[model samples]
Target chain A: MSIKDCLGIQDEELVKKSLENIDYFACIYERYEKKLIRYILRISSFSYHEAEEVLQEAFVRVWRNLNEFDESLKFSSWVYRIVHNTTITEWRKTQSKGKDRKQDIDDELYKNLPSNLNIEKELGRKIDADGIKRVLDLMPEKYRSVLILKFLEEKDYNEISDILKKPTGTVGTLINRAKKSFNQIADKENITFTV
Target chain B: MENSQKLLDKIQKENIEQRKKSEFAAKNIFFWTMFTLSVLIGGLATSVLIFAFGQTEFDLLSHITHSRVELFLGMLPIVWIFFSFVFLAASIALLRKTKKGYKYSPVLVLMGNLIMSLILGTVIYFSGGAVKIESIFAKNVPGYQSVEEKKTAIWSAPEDGFLSGTIISVENEVILQDWNGKDWKIDTKDALIRGRVSMRIGEEVKIIGEMSSEGLFKASEIRPWKGQGNGANHVNN
Candidate 1:
């Protein structure tokens, strides 16, 4: 199929075609490349270069395990799941090697956070993007990941559940707790939110 | 876009092949088989646990000790209960490894496992499977005690006004061999025989009486060794 045709086809269809022809796999990689790199950077201490490496490895794994993919799950969720696992494994490897990688969220990405988070109502003061970023960085990885997936990535509960391989109820609970934790960290840091 | 092309080019150069669908199918089948086996084992354990509880003489707690807690603790069947929960947890963990297993909450999974075990266990218990399995374990497994053996131990305290034995003879004076193979002459003339008390030879019986002398037991009441074998209660006056 042509590049235009591949772009028009759905992810599930692309996955089926990719199995028959390796070239079709390029469309799958291209489709998720940008979004997944951003996801890896948000959830891990990886730099852009390292995140790209992880994404590349993750896509290769996705290719090898294509037949194992459950047809019932959304293709986007499956790809995200692979990316999440791959990033976490790499993160652990870096930690064990005593590499102290600084987690940095892009300032531009922070500015794009949705306003519906109701952080202003919870903190009783208007909080800026930088203040939110600080609170998120200080939170535990589990809570931080859930918040990023839910609020920043604009993923629903079901999507988060599929990506994390957690129950939807657990996903909801995690998001609520993550928000509470984020607020607590904000309060503890005593960041002066501009009114 | 550059990295994407790089990956695609690498995939073509290396000729990376997708894993066969049968591998995933086999892995899924293995997990499901293990999950089912765990549940079935758990159910069987539950059945044995129920049977053990059923065989216990809870009514005789008053006779054993003043504290109900002591009697309860003594007859709790800890081994069977442990095995049941161990297998239950195993089943739950195995189920969670399946593709769609994470969709269900832990509470829901636990409840589902418990219900399946209870239903399967009850069926097995009623079908007498529990009794046969219990007996086999008691005989083969070292340090494993059956409910019947436990009951015998409870009722074998001749000095404490309880004695149980197989009847050697049931004539003017009952000749019985206690669980420890000691012979005793039981005087049941003034005894109240409760339930379906079969005073036939080789029949096992429990006597609530004191050791009058060396090999003699003066009986006040007699009961079938198994359960309160319900029938017409009689007096051997």
Candidate 2:
């Protein structure tokens, strides 16, 4: 049976098994590849190729540093942190090269956002996907990252803090600021939902 | 999907190495060691500055006998205090860089640095290293004399002035090494000697006196200087 076929196995348990048999590590790569690609794409505005390169580097780092992973943290959070750092480093290098990637909002990510989240309601109206994308791109990186992690990735404050390497209170503050900025931007742009 | 498979195959082909737990622990140990050393050095620096302040001849109570606020403000050790704050900031920055530093809030980390400095300061005080370090700074660091000189000028004023110094000699009169290391001849014939009134060479004494034209200090009273707060009542000139 494929490792993916093994249901109910926690990521932590997978890490322990992968420590003994390196081949089992492929399971971790398989599980997180798409999610990480999406996250890196959204955060760094990387094209799929650039995102793939970052993903490969991030997985390599995780594989080499597996033993250094603290069991106290969720394995997913730890993996995402490595990916986050690697992507930011890649993003900086890309910036230095004066290459800009169109920050095309992934339809899957946009669709996956919870319908009940206030990003739409707070505008006192609904914004189309293009309006939402424009508002997100206009905001500062700090606020944009928090909004993506909160609404897009659906991470709670603690997990967001772990991934961002910030305190939970700081994460809360960033979310509040992001929401306010989003409301103002949407209002300024006059986004209205069509039936 | 094929690309994901290739990445997995790459991991298997490379035989990626897992970092040793000892190495992880070593990194943590190294960060903590640097943090602790920073705090200790910062604390010792703070204690040294405090000791220099303590060794000053500016008697707060006596200076208050003039204009309280001006004297207090003038005698404030602004330079040493600035140094203390700089050391504190360095310690806090090091603490934040530690591996588990982010686990504590910034305020908690700052308070931790302060408490560490306080504890280390007390230890340095008891070990008598504070005074030694203070003297070293005074001699070696530039502008060290400026703060001290201002304090001595305020303390050694000529009229109704107060001075505390080590008695260099005591024959018919007392020769003192004053706070600024200058010699002062005190005429104690008309003075009231208080507080276990025994005179000896090398003992510290506080004298309240008038400055004669001959540049000798005519004492109205002399009291044994029993460190701080012991001879406040003796300033009777």
Candidate 3:
């Protein structure tokens, strides 16, 4: 089928086709590749190259475990879960190797953050994207990941819970705590907002 | 698009196969089975614990020299309690590993397991399954003492005003052989028999009375060996 036809097909249906023929798997891969890579970059200190590597590995795992995926869950959530785990595992391996990893937030991605985050109302000033990135870098990994999933990815609590393998209540709590932590870190850093 | 093409080419180059659906199904079934078994075993432990507490004669602590606190502490079935908690933890861990198990909060999961075990335990206890299981364990398992055995041991102290034995004869003075095979002459003229206790020959009885002399015990009250008799009828002599 053409790309237009594939675009119209749902992810769950695509998974069945992908399982039968490897060529159909390309459609699933193309659908999630960019989003998954952006998610990896947001949640970790991975470079574009490293994020691409992680996404590739994660998609391969998704292919191998296609039959294991539960139909009840949104296919995107399952893919995100695999990508999240893969990113974390890869990050841990790099840390163990004593690699000096640095946070690399894309300027384009950061520019979109303020619109999604209602922080301007609370701060009474327009906080810049760099300040948000700095505060996210300063925050703990658990809190940072939750914030990235909530604000950056625009995922709801149930979706976040599915991806993180946490209860919906715990996901809500984590997101609240993450936002609070972010404000506290921003305050500590004394980030000057452009009014 | 280029990366996707490259990955697709790599997939074609390498013979990577999707894992069978049956494999995931087996894993899910295994986790669910283990979780259910853990809860069931936990319930059994709880039932046995209830039975142990039920058979404990807390009211008879007044007759013994030891304090009530000491007797109560000594009577606690630590092994059964430990088993119950172990099974509970196992069930919780196994459940968390299952699909959608992480959807529940830890407190909710813990309470759910505990309440389920309690409900199952109460049913088992009321159905008399616990007693039968305890009896089997006591007779067959080495060093394993049933609640009845523990009760018998607690009541076997003659000097402390507690004695239990099988009645050899019911005469003017009863001849009773204690658990240790030693015979005792019990004076029952002023004794008050509690519950529906039969003073017939070969009947096991628990007496709350002091040792008057060697091999002789003065009985203040007599009760059946099984339990603190539910019957309030006091046969006074």
> Which candidate's TM-score is highest?
1
For candidate 3, the docking band is: medium
Residue A113 CA error for candidate 1 (Å)? 1.4
lDDT (Cα, tens digit) per residue for candidate 3, span B1-237: 577777777777797777899999999999999999999999999999998988777777766766667667767877788989999999999999998899999999999999999998999999998888788888898998678778877788787788998999887779999999999999987888877788899999899888999999999989888877667656466
Second chain TM-score, each model: 0.81, 0.64, 0.83
Every candidate's DockQ is 0.76, 0.50, 0.74
By DockQ, the better pick of 2 and 3 is 3
State the lDDT of candidate 1 residue by residue for B1-237, as single tens digits. 477679988887898777999999998899999999999999999999999988877766666444568557767888899999999999999999987889999999999999999999999999999999998999899998778777777788787678998999877778999989999999998888986887899998888877899899999888998787668888888
For residues A76-182, what per-residue lDDT tens digits would candidate 2 score against the true structure?
88898899889888888888899764566766656534365655554455655666677777777788888888877778888887788777877888898888888
TM-score of model 2's chain A: 0.87
Deviation in Å, model 2, residue B165 alpha carbon: 4.1
Error of 1 at B171 (Å): 6.4
- C-alpha positional error of residue B161 in candidate 1 after TM-score superposition, expressed in Å: 4.9
Which segments of model 3 are wrong by more than 4 Å?
A1-5, A100-106, A119-128, A183-195, B60-70, B126-128, B159-161, B185-192, B209-221, B233-237
Q: Which stretches of candidate 2 lie over 4 Å from their true place?
A: A1-6, A112-127, A184-195, B12-16, B56-87, B127-129, B132-203, B206-226, B229-237
> Model 3, range A67-104, lDDT digits (tens) per residue?
99898999999999999999999998998999755665
Q: How accurate is candidate 3 locally (lDDT)?
A: 0.85
Model 1: lDDT to the true structure: 0.85
Worst 10 residues of 3 chain B by lDDT: B228-237
